[model samples]
Target: MAKTQEFKATERIEAPQGGPGRGAMGGGMVGQKAMEFVPSGKRLAARLRPDRGKAVLVVLLGVVSVALMSVGPRILGHATDIVFNGFIGKQIPPGTPESEWPQAVQGMDVVPGQGVDFDAVAHVLMIVLAIYVGASVLGWLQGFILNTVVQNTVRTLRQDVEDKINRLPLGYFDRSPRGELLSRVTNDIDNVSTTLQQTMSQLLTSVMTVFAVLAMMFWISPLLALVALVTVPMSLLVTAQIMKRSQGQFVAQWRRTGALNAHVEESFSGHALVKVFGRQEEVEAKFAEENDELAKVSFGAQFVSGLIMPSMMFIGNLNYVLVAVIGALRVANGQLSLGEVQAFIQYSRQFTQPLTQIASMVNLLQSGVASAERVFELLDADEEPVDATGAAAPGRRGEVAFEHVSFRYDEDRPLITDLSLVARPGQTVAIVGPTGSGKTTLVNLVMRFYDIDAGRITLDGVDITAMPRAALRSQVGMVLQDTWLFAGTIRDNIAYGRPGATEDEILAAARATFVDRFVHSLPDGYDSLIDEEGSNLSAGERQLITIARAFLTDPALLILDEATSSVDTRTELLLQHAMAALRTDRTSFVIAHRLSTIRDADLILVMEEGAIVEQGTHEELLAASGAYARLYQSQFTAAAVGEEV
Candidate 1:
């Protein structure tokens, strides 16, 4: 039977302190904060290090594109100068280029009687258009390269997560919530992907644009450029303040999202149980509470980050007005041309545009960093111990022994100590125990699901730990109390036991386990489809399929842990006969609550509190009249009283 461990509600719902969800929504102690922003951001960036070559290429493209776009305003300013000079110079005498004109036209290049240089202006406009087109083309190419890099990086991250899941010890799954783990794998990774896709290209372009446009601004008019630079500090102050306030909320939002997803998954998976217990209102109330918390944090994050762009724009407009006034005065004093002033004003707008963009991207960057930290935590978890090098392989004779083995799930609480047992070749050993008596745990040790802390377990006198886990487990087959079936045809599910089994072998195993009795009656025989949940099959039918699956492995040893507990009396009797045949010439460990099922076994072990209290044939154990005798008598009395009622 599967052993159930007791845990507090809080333990199931929350991660350990200082883990991924240590923020406000994670139910940490008061005053605890999420992970620091800079470290998490740096860790996220490290994931992209493998693609640094591509990243550098993307940066180059962005710089070149911004450079091309920045010169357009200067070219357009030249066209403006041509028109202004022509208007002022029309009143001068013909061919009077002798620098004797009025102050407005003194420094201007004007031709007498020339109303306006339409041809020159058109030529300049065309050059500006070509520059913009080149910039657009480079921008598109940069986006394409960046998309490839981001997608490849995220793909590698997903594969790493998948591999890590396999390496994690089974105990990790026992302590962690299924929904929370799923949220990390699916929701958090996806958030990271989206964040990278949306922000990477834009951020690169925005920062480059800031530098390129600022340089152009200084080239056009240093005084106006300085005036524009004044707003830089104010923009930085606003962004820093807002980002500081919103960073925690962004972390809290993702954590709350995970918690809510966990609750929803648990409720739905146990929907029938919740209805049986009449806890629908309580479940809904909890859902509402979590949903409300998620909404509040999400709102706070968006609202705070949303303040950045407007503040930047406000500061930018002030800079623009100040520049326009000063440049106009400079033009009037003949210190700068009207065209230069026009170009400087345009450069000022371009400069602030990128700052606003950077401000707007703060929310995405923060959220992405939060999710990336969660993923990193999963990757950094301690994995199961590595397999021994040059490992031995177990012999197929099926002789198993535990020599003074000691094991415990926790350091301070010992479960099994100084336990020793032997199962000889081809013998059926039945283990009878109450819940938490270490029956299943003993089987787990035999399979090396959890390693023993002291002493050695051997198969055919070869230490199991010395053998690779695959080699050791290949010799054994297990049938658990829970029956799991994926979405596939019945034949496919049966063949999963031994992937390359022939049709005849599948049929033989099915007949031996009595799965063939009902399989042939279905509409498609072995080809009938089963849903992911296997809801179409009865409980007994599901157990029969699992038994057939175990039979197909043709293993040297078999474990049946409450395998027939779900079947009815008639089906149980049939399975007992089938199992008796399957156990021939193979060592078998049968864990059962029903004494009648193991009466004919070669050996029976009565275990209590992780130690064997009695061992003998059923008749011999009954003759001793010990703990086994009391348990049998109590069960017999209860059955007799129930029949009388």
Candidate 2:
């Protein structure tokens, strides 16, 4: 009968957006400067250290393949010379050797009266083909090995991230958005995988090809090789300038991506609430703003990085023109053979092609490193204090005592101070107060979700801190106001309380908590599949299932925080009866705002502003005419007025 609170339309929505006390926005990297390339690149490279042997083999195969392919053009050039020599010889005097020919033909290896040697050309072509075929086979083998190494490295990285998430403290999660954390784990890690997969083999091959082709170029003609080398500095200048401009844009692009994902996730999770409050337009407007920001940064990053390829191509063309004119002049002066000139031209093309490939791969490397930095940040976060080694075992008798405990979420604002209480075995202690009265915090301390700042808490005369967290928690059972059920069958959800519970034990717990009343009516009975959100079940039905889960644990201590607040009157009454049966031989802590539910509690403690104000049985507190009497009278008068109306 208490007055129900109405939510105003102007109330601020609790969407997971950027603000103070919520940690950094945009996957915890917003407003921070872009990370330096060298350190991040090195750290990313460290992830590949485990597979270094396979990586070395990949590099060796690439080098061997490039070496074989580099020799093809020079060998093929010999065939060209043979044909040219034979044609000249056929036009000369009969039966005359090349030494007796004119000065222009004297240097050519040709015999008079001989036509083109088709058999010699065929033999050269076959050798070149065989070299190319060997190179191709080696390339394929290296690709296969490189792929395996990359996938294994990524798998190990994913496992590290998963383990890191478990080690972080509850306070870290309270300050971070769920969506942002998920983005770091899923989106960032996936981008890292793709970047490594696409860039590793190609980058290695291109670099090796560049060196191999350069050595061949100099071996053919040093002067022409130097002319081709003129473009190397120019290409590097262009690459450095463009990459410097695009690096920050790439960082912004990924940061905005995380923010956009966070907004969308929060909006979808609370879509019903948003629609009920008529805030769809506001949500859409915010989405549009973030989407526009992401698009703008993406465009800038791509546009700047796109200049590398065209710029490299232009310089390469200039180098090619210089090499061709010089080589033709050298050939006309009889300083080089026509075949050598042709081979040099092919080598020029090969040289510039690898440079172009290297320039293009820079963009992918930058983006990958950016994502790796974000993932490394998650792995470097401060974790919870390590559990005690060889800690003492907890007693099964649930006698909990809090002695002068003091705690605070923030250093400047004190929450619970000098709080002391004791709950003997087989007792029911009810806590009653208004909102922000530290009722939930009390139980949370008992569960050790957040360690206290000072003083000690104990179970069965042993300090809770002296026992391992898992050992201490194993003897306690808790039921929160919000119900959580994974996507699984009803029987599976119930069995989650005890992993190896028998079918008979599960049925017994379900029947004891009245969950069988509705579950039996479903077509699949206990085998019915529940979606992740459990939308298939009603509110009361879900609560009943959670209660049944707690019952199956059969713990010595139980904590129920507003467990009946969301159910209807009939359902609440049924739950109260079931809870009574469950608490027959266990110590139970109940936190409630509806005073009627705690009338029969052995001890009722009234709290105000994080301090205990009064304590006694319900009738005794009412007789004393204190804070408890005021709260009861107001509710009783409101109920009577509603009945009269």
Q: Can you give the TM-score per candidate against the true fold?
A: 0.93, 0.91
Candidate with best TM-score? 1
**lDDT by residue for model 2 (306-391), tens:** 89999999999999999999999988776778889999999999999989988888888888887887788788888877888878
Question: Over 4 Å off in model 2, which ranges?
Answer: 1-34, 91-113, 623-626, 633-645
* lDDT at residue 79 of model 1 (Cα atoms): 93
- What stretches of model 1 exceed 4 Å from their correct place? 1-34, 91-102
CA shift at 484, candidate 2, in angstroms? 0.6
